[model samples]
Target: MVSAFAITRFASGLISGTLVDKFGERAVFSSGVFMVALFTFLAGLSQSYEQLLFFRAAGGLGSSMFSVAAGSVILRSVDDANRGRAQSVYQGSFLLGGIAGPAIGGLLSVISLRAPFFVYSGLLLCSGMVAFFFLKGDKIGKEDKNADISEHTTVREALAMKPYRIALVLSFIGAWVFFGLRASILPIFVTEELNSTTAVVGYGLALSAVVQGVILLKAGRYSDEKGRRAASIIGAQVVLLGVLLLTFSVNFWMFLLSMAVLGFGGAFISITPASIVGDVIKGKGGKVIAIFQMAGDAGMMVGPIIIGAVSDLFSYRAAFGMSAAIFVIALVLVYQIPETRNVEGPQVKNLRPLDEDL
Candidate 1:
């Protein structure tokens, strides 16, 4: 648990983004998938936990590499008008993975923990091969080699953009609450607080995931027409309500309701942030995006460690309540950030020439 994904998942965005920016998406993705495929297979062969961590870390880097590079590639490949739908599909994959992994892991765990590793490897290897052949549109090779994207745009710049900064901070806080509950506190709530059976908790989680998946689909389209800020306001409230349910839940019905609400709110946070970052990294697609993805990974990494630690020493109720506080922070930050819906400014026209339209 300590080494399986925590360290590796943390570094995915930065490493992947840099590779994409430097080498290009097709190459980076191919290399990343190959890494995951190789290590996942090797992880299955390993007999010790330490060895598993090493293998998993390698795979995590590869997986993250694909995300950073590929995400940027998708954004840059399309026009602003199509980004919302594109982001929906991309971000939806995460929730899909979260949903599928446990099911696959469960089925495979019956055979052995190593079983899933081999399965993951083969899948990545197949994807890597496909990307190598099908990515005919990559412009990385054609762009200015000494592009000002890297030198001029810094983390400070990202922070300086009020909207970007708000997005980043809110992303961090949102991740803190979302992941902290799943990793540190949810099981405790089920077993100790609710006296729920293991199967019940599993089913509850599955249902919530399904709800989140639906929300992502619907909200993506909704946010495309409405401002992202509007989606965020409603999303924050949904999560706030979900957290409250978890804290005050008295029965299985309440627990189920909390999960659904949590899923609903969480979906908006996931969908909006990706598109927002895409907007910020308009020109230097890969490099700027890498920084953004890295910041997100850093937040996800730090959240459980800090929040979980606090929860471990204190009560479960307090841990959940604390997570809600983080959501509130996200809400406030989102409020301050300027909405990018229907970008209407002179700066935008000048920044991106309509050289091509998707």
Candidate 2:
């Protein structure tokens, strides 16, 4: 079931980004939200496993659409000067929702097993309505002076830039470590290796989220002020340190401390990569943004399976060492890319035509 949803979401990412470019974010965003709401509501009413699976898979398309459009909206609406801060707030909201969602679902489950789904669907519907009503005008940002709304940086053009290429790597690493491996492997490691309970896993995760949430705004501000390169390098180093800590951990306190460190690193990861993408494109680049989103999604999908395999074949320490190695590579790449805090406006230079390179 999980695989079904992830596969469909991954498959639809490019298409959703293209659609967002053509139709604009207001329509694409609302439609995507509505589709998720509709499918989720149907899933809630499903009488069989097959029905639930089908609904969840179909919802993945909407999820892709929503995610790509949301990124596009952020890229389009926010200027370079404040983009990092904007992304921080955006990511922080998701963190808040992540913390709240399971609890809310648990509460709703007391009413009925399906109650949470229905309520979630209703909330999505409300959000869609809000997007439809509030996301008015063609260009939301005052700095967006591109007379041609149709003008967009192509994927090839975006990839040609050193900063953007590095940004994609950062995005993938961020998702792989923070979203994928941490969620999937850490709990098992806690129970089996640390001789801890599931409750400890929950506490560890919550502590990580709290630590991450606390630093998000500050991280964003730092990215905005210090430069994306600095943020990315620091984030990668800290994440590597955290992973190494986890690799050597023998007690619950060390595990919890590593989680906190990882969380602190994650805030910078969440902010800088997106900010770098925004810095590169500086305007509508739905396909470009889509590719960026896909990198992270791909990481989220692949990280667990591969890392879990490593754990099964060798040991948890080896698996974590592998992750740490990857971060080391990412950190080196971060050093190669230029700072992008001042890379603003619609007229980016040296971008070849889309057809010229491919």
Candidate 3:
């Protein structure tokens, strides 16, 4: 069931991006949210596993649509000077919701197994309605009227740039470690290797989320002020340290420390790569943004399987060491890419011409 949703979401991402580019973020995002709400409501009423699976998979289409459109909206609306802060706020909100969502679902589930679904569906419907009614469509591409032809970047053109190519890799690595390998393997490692309970896993994850959430805004501000390369190099190095800590950890305390480190470093990575993509496009490249989104989704899908296989064939330490190696590669790539901050105003016109090698 999970694979079904992931596959569909991955496959539909480009379609969502195209729609956002054509219709604008407000319309596409609202329509996507409404579609998700309808499908989720149907899922709650499913009488069989097949029906539930079908509804869930169908919902992935909407999920991809809104997710891509949301990224498009952020890229289009925010300027280079404030883009990092904007992305940081966006990520921090997502972290807060992620931390709270399970708890809310648990409470709803107490009423009935399907209660959470119903509640989630209703909330989504409300959100979609609010967005459709209140969001200003004119703000998304307000600068497009005066945008030079060079301001519009195609996916191929974006990929040709060095920073953007590296940004895609960084996005993949970020998702691979944080969303995929850690989520899938950490619990098992805690329970089986460290001899800890599931409760310990939850505590560690909660701690990580809390730490990440608390630091996200500061990280964003730092990226805005210090430049993307500075923030990304620092972040990648810290993440490397955390993964190494995880690799060598022999007890619960060390594991907890590793999680905290991962969280702290993750906040930097979470915002900077998106900011880089936004910088490259200068706030108008739906197809370019879509390809970037697809890279992370691919990481989320592939990372667990590859890392888990290493764990099964070798050891948990080996699996973590593998993750550390990937982080090392990301750090090197980050170092090679040029700083992508403060590239707005008069300098914007020279961006493409400067990257003539691409």
Name the best candidate (by TM-score): 3
Q: Write the per-residue lDDT of candidate 2 for residues 158-268, one digit (tens) a residue.
A: 889998988888888878888666767888899999999999998889998999999999999888878888888888888888999999999999999999999998888
Query: Which window of 10 residues has the lowest lDDT sum in candidate 1?
Result: 345-354
* Order of candidate numbers by lDDT, starting with the best: 3, 2, 1
Please list the C-alpha lDDT of all candidates, in the order they appear.
0.72, 0.84, 0.85
Evaluated with lDDT, which candidate comes out highest? 3
The alpha-carbon root-mean-square deviation between model 1 and the true structure, to one decimal in Å, is 3.2
lDDT of candidate model 1 versus the reference: 0.72
- Order by TM-score, highest first: 3, 2, 1
Kindly give the stretch of ten consecutive residues in candidate 3 with the minimal lDDT sum: 345-354
After superposition, the stretches of candidate 1 with alpha carbons farther than 4 Å from their true spots are 1-4, 9-15, 138-143, 146-156, 343-358
lDDT by residue (252-348, candidate 3, tens digit) is 9999999999999999989999998888785456678888988998898888888889999999889989999988999898789798776453224
TM-score of each candidate structure, all chains considered together: 0.89, 0.92, 0.93
lDDT for 30 (candidate 2): 90
Q: List the residue pairs that clash in candidate 1.
A: 16-65
C-alpha RMSD of each candidate structure in angstroms: 3.2, 4.9, 4.3
